[model samples]
Target: MSSHYGQFCPVAKAMELLDERWTLLVVRELMMGSRHFNALRRGVPRMSPALLSKRLQTLVRAGVVERWDDGNRVTYQLTEAGKELEPIVEALGRWGTRWIPELGDEDLDPHLLLWGMHRNVDLEAVPDGRTVIRFLFPDVPAPSRRWWLVISADGVDICDEDPGFPERVGVEGSLRTLIRIWRGDLDWAAALRSGTLTLDGTAQAQRALPRWLKLSPLAGTPRPYAAAG
Candidate 1:
């Protein structure tokens, strides 16, 4: 894990521990309070299980993570040293949100998108009664292509399996389109006009979508973007 920078600086020393692939992301998940192994994997889905395990062990060795047992299952938690990294992780996310130029096809992941949505939905806009919104993403794999977001005054439930509730509205589109929509890179009206995004359901539900759907936290933040040629 040590990549020598050939410098005697503290920054270089820090980089050696933090620069490993998936290391910071694992930290991000931990900082976000994902304690179990499965939750961490969901947060960083593309990382191999073997590698995630290795990364966690490395962090523990570096005094950033601690492994413990609750007498039922093993758990991992961040040490004070790792907790100290919260601001750095957040700054990196904000910086990337503001400066990352473009997104590639490989970057579109339904699991991650839904996970983010589950964590960020604006409950205040939820319908007074039980409301179901389904999404169809043709570009995602069959198992994850369809998603149901069931929300009520009580709470929001995001499900990969069919919740079987009568949906009030449905959104059908490519996975990338949905990702861009959430990221605020595409205008909802323009998307509908272009037929890239389609809405189905009661006129009332259709009309309420734009206002009811709360997007990414960084969606409104102005960023320097680079267009693809």
Candidate 2:
């Protein structure tokens, strides 16, 4: 733990623990139901594994997180105190989506985006069958350009490896456009009409995509303040 504020107050006390770099984001991931260490890293990919381990240990000591060992893998979960931070995390995301300045190239990451979409996609909206959709981001690194979403009644699997299965839909677009679409900054119809996003493969897959993709939960939050400079 870092040095104390040398004073006693609720806000200051909380900040002493949660305000550290990556601390709140770790909490945010835990609140978002990330149970595995690798899963948490997806939400904050730039954070080093060593630093993340340290943060997890710090949070554990702070009684904000709990670890469970099942003989196979050790999973982490937020404790009661950690669960209390859901509103805080939600508020932060809502605020960022509303007031944060316009999107930039640096803000788009295909790996993280695919990881988030894997969890946020509306599985029920997809037709009842094995659906494979390949997303191609032309501007990203070649290795990271292609992402495959294999969705079935069981669950969704995101991978860079080709599953060899016939793709039901192929989406070719830049990462920025996809991010904008996901953030609700750009509408699906507009992207399609503008040709920034291309839809191919089966007709059903293209039709189901709009309904299957449910944007960030905070996407609907309204911005009451002016955009940041």
For residues 29-136, could you state the per-residue lDDT of candidate 2 as single tens digits? 887778998889988998999999999999999999998896798899988998888888888888888878377777788988887788887887887788888999
Off by over 4 Å in 1: 152-156, 225-229
Evaluated at residue 28, the lDDT of candidate 2 is: 82
Give lDDT tens digits, candidate 1, residues 1-229: 7678989999998999999999999998888678899889989999999999999999999999999886887788999999999889888877887888478988999888877777666677767888898999987789888998888877777798889889999999998887888887787887888888899999888988877777877677676764221
Instruction: Assess the local accuracy of residue 81 in candidate 2 as a C-alpha lDDT between 0 and 100.
Output: 92
Once model 2 is optimally superposed onto the true structure by TM-score, how far is the C-alpha of residue 121 displaced, in angstroms? 1.9
Clashing pairs in 2: none
Each model's lDDT comes to 0.85, 0.85
